[model samples]
Target: MADQTRRVHFVLSTHWDREWYMTFQQFRYRLVKLMDRILEGWNTGELQGPMQTDGQAVLLEDYLEVRPERRAEIEQRAREGKLVIGPWYAMPDEFLVSGESLVRNLRLGREVARQFGGTPSCAGFTCDIFGHNSQLPQIYAGFDQAAALIWRGVNTWDKRTLPWEGADGTVMPAFRFGLSGYCTYAHKVRGRPGSPESSDPDWVRRQIDDQLAWDAECTDTDAILFFDGCDHNEWDPLSYRILAERFEEESGGFEVVHTDLDAFVKEMAAQADRIQTRVVGELREPAEHSLMRDNQWLIPGVMSSRVWIKQDNAACEKLLTRHAEPLGALSNYLLNREYPSGLLNVAWRWLLKNHPHDSICGCSIDQVHEDMKFRFSQCRGIGEVITSDTLLRLAANVGEPVEADSTRVLLWNGALTPVDGSVEVTLQIPADWPTFNEFFGFELKPGFRIYDAEGN
Candidate 1:
């Protein structure tokens, strides 16, 4: 009863964490070697690539920072469809950052992809995020994403593919990762000297058969996806050859092809009408059938673990969106001041770098989080300076200059609607004023009083 004509799509990818157990520079060192192997494999005919860079374009940025001379080669591979990237600048945890941050992440990622002469993949690839938000389907739909490939925080009910519906009722096709997740065929395809696949010639065949059997049980689609890489994995020079040879010579009535997420998404879209299950609003079930002994539960503790990081993240986000950006744009519109788009972009990029799951989740090593603190400070500093400059400029544009001895306070609301509440303002007293004693609490000379613009 097995489907003999099924086609297996082998997606070779490495989930590159910009920083995790090691620091960013250390990880980038490994990434440089990985990229070298991948590019060399493709150039020397060792790998028939269409390798996915974990659905993030920042990895390319990281690789290029160290290997600037290889830009042309990398672009050539991307142009030739040997490299797949984007749809996210970095794979960030959904709940940790502001929703606007996620949008900018996608926009920046797509822009980076285009800069590299490659079209970003439209698949919502949530490969290793701790969990997903409810509005993700709508967000993906807004970006015209075709489908989603998910691994964690989902209960597929034994079905490999289903329709995921967002809170607002937007729906998209979603493909769930199987028991072994993205590394199902990783070890088998790139066997080490004493690994099971190398010790026994028949081991690879049996593994493939078992994988295909599991795929059969999960979904009835003719296209089966086999992810052939894992965390920080290097390019396997022989992966394509090994898979191609097995499917070619064994003649097990199956076909294997080296492909990427885009093609796989297209395959899923083709079978959309037949997909029966429809999941609604946020997948955070932590399905009990996961390959991990811990059942792949969502690590909820990360939300409050090292809470200061989250507080700083929120503070930066508010400063950027609620104050800095809005004021900058208003000043640009009304005062004819040039908008600081480039500077804002830089600020956002610094903040978004901290949004990655491991980095923002505070689950990484001390060095990683330490690096994050610096980025947060940089972002905060930019937002604060911009807000301060814009406020001063706007105040100067609207109000006349005050006397040297007089004090003038400016209160401008950045909100769209009228807000009436008790407001606190800091007053800079003249240096000549008497300082208050800690014990006696003496009153300062020339007591200040508040006044409206009409002199009330």
Candidate 2:
């Protein structure tokens, strides 16, 4: 066991989720509001501070509220290497979007991480997924991630161990979550002053204790503890006070500390060899049905930070994975010359501001059309061809691979610019393999299948 006296890992994690589809004015307004809120807590000594005097603060911003103007500040932090702007995917319901849509979100999340002061070479999945599918390891591995920060269904890979391999046979990032690591939480009351939920101290403490306790059977393993950000206590003075006291009282031993996913994942990676692995499924408490339209977002699915974030940090894991291949290639292709990979960053924000389909609130069909056209136009100067991987990503997200979509393969000047020919894709489809063939045009092989859209 980790030494009890000096083993407490005090973590301070705060959520920054933004919805960007609104007018820039609204976008900026929300930005200011979020910043103010964060500042208020930090200034007031409310946030869980670093251990010594005031606890160190780690801000985990979910790209739910993204804008170009704010990008500079975020990028500055990343460049400075002080803070880690983890991953760029919109939160929640990964399945609701097309596969390409999912990857696009992943791409943007990492692009911003590079711009910001954080190194998301690894990813985080803040979500507590209904099923932490086996195939994720391959998808994530394709992006070159070492580990992930998450808490989902009881499913584990490699016969119950860390870094489970997916259907594509890729190893996943190290996974962690919670008060100890599986799922994190400070307080989330409902229907009360703090949460619209009760701020009962007894109720909250019990929840925290449950997460912090250790399991003996969890020997020689790689697992994650996710703190549930039920968020009902966002502004609850009482809960904050109790939380602060808990940290002070239990400063020694492996005490409870609220923390960001990045900080923890870094700890695991530095000692990756020691970590073990396993594969197990939830025969215990089952995951809730995906109650919301897409993951858990305010506007149903496209990209609103509100409900979407509680879905967990899965976006970060996926994003870091998605960018690894292209970034490595682009770095080599750079030959010390700047090849404008940053263009992908601009294109990323454009898409986040205008994801396909409509928001969960049900806008007019005309509103959807207007949003798409405006977004497509914004993406025009983004220079998609800079990376074959990027263009192919566009094709996959375009859906159905029609012949005319600009993203589709086209012929001009006696040369053929391939659409799906950009990047190869592979995943572990189900026994219901035909569902994939009907949609994505592929068959699930027995184990670890791969599809090279842009193959040799």
Candidate 3:
């Protein structure tokens, strides 16, 4: 027998990657099957849930895209609060994408969760990202999230619960799942923790005691959090009952309950002084090689792998932010017209799908990166069209004249003040038209030359 005050919360969650090494279609088949099993078991009283996802709304979106008929059942489960989802469109690689994109991801996630009759969990779930950035607290706080459940980038000296601070002096609770990661305490019974081969009375008592002892060493709180799932894990719907019954049999010193990150954060907050509070920002440690011992992985080099993808991603981001959005807004304001929000969203979703750590890092299978290249192409193509259309409309309204054998172009400075820049024009001449050598009185260069729009 131990102290009466000790308690433990078993968090049942899956760190779901919508697509990583596997293609989205391949994963969606498994996802549909898994959700069907989970819902059926719960409806028939075979599964107990408070199950949480990796704070991703994109998985549900992908699932609904394929199986719109099951929307009612999924929505019902979400309303019951048995299914936890969102607070993120996808679990993004923070540093690889822009800070603004991070905010938009959360915004879309929350919107999707509400559409499904579910309130997005208030916890920031950052389980699988290779590392975290300094402004994460601000981003999460902007969404009104209370805490973050993180797996990587914690030192041995750091406590399980620490205060994470952002650049703007915002602070929030952060939970690190140790070097072993989220599924640390899971037993090998049914691929989920807290389940065993034998639920015999003696085995139950021993298991509880061992767990309690291990729990004590990890944190100062009497409550222990055992994350029960891993990447792409589909839960055994009936396993929660097995854990509940076994814990009930050996109910001597502690209580066990299936809970979520939100509940755990609230419980810990009730006894705030017990959790060590220290300001933390951008954390990158316990390198990829080190995590291999614990059966976990995080490759930092993915940030630079497949340099072409990274370059394209940066160009797409710039084209949208610098050119399309500003030009669209200016056209809308001056001409009383609307920008193509639907097409813009379609383009954004395509890009965001490629933001997952493994996909963006170019560390996944060849097929996944190949698909990413295609998605990047689509994103850029859409952005370029939007920018081109907006610019054309604005130019037409400028009422510039077309002189003989020459064209007039109007270029607006999208910035606050005038900017000094160069514009290059390429001309394709017909057989009857003047040759470059004849026109310029010299031999033509191989390619187009850069010059000022003013013909300098």
Query: Order the candidates by lDDT, highest first — what do you get?
Result: 1, 3, 2
lDDT of 1 by residue, 1-456 (tens): 344566677788898888989999999989999988888777787676588889899999888988999999889878877878789998889998889999999999888888898888887888887778998888888888899887678766467788888999988898877655665556544556446555454665566677667776677566778887688987654445556675433256667777888888888788788788778887887557634422356787888888999999999998999899999999999999999998999998999899999999999999899899899999999999999999888877665576575566778776668878998877777776444445666744445566666556
lDDT of 3 by residue, 104-184 (tens): 788888888898898898989888788789899888888888788776765533356777777778877777776467655
Give residue 243's lDDT in candidate 3 (0 to 100).
66
Q: Which stretches of candidate 2 lie over 4 Å from their true place?
A: 1-31, 44-83, 89-108, 126-144, 151-162, 173-207, 214-237, 248-253, 268-277, 280-345, 352-373, 380-410, 413-456
Assess each prediction's global lDDT (C-alpha) against the native: 0.80, 0.41, 0.72
Full-model lDDT, candidate 1: 0.80
Clashes of each: 0, 83, 1
lDDT head-to-head 1 vs 2, winner = 1
| TM-score-superior candidate, 1 or 3 | 1
lDDT of 2: 0.41
Query: Per-residue alpha-carbon lDDT of model 2 for 1-456, expressed as tens digits?
Result: 343332224343333223224533343455455544544565566754421100011123322244435555545544544344445344433433445555566666665455455555454454433244444555555555556544444433112125555555555544533222221244322123445234677776554455444321332333223333332113345555655566536442444455444555555555556556644321122333343211221232323333332222223223322443354344446443354546655655554544322332223243444444555455543433444454444445433553331223411121223354454444333453333234665754344233334431
TM-score of each: 0.92, 0.51, 0.85
Candidate ranking (TM-score, best to worst):
1, 3, 2
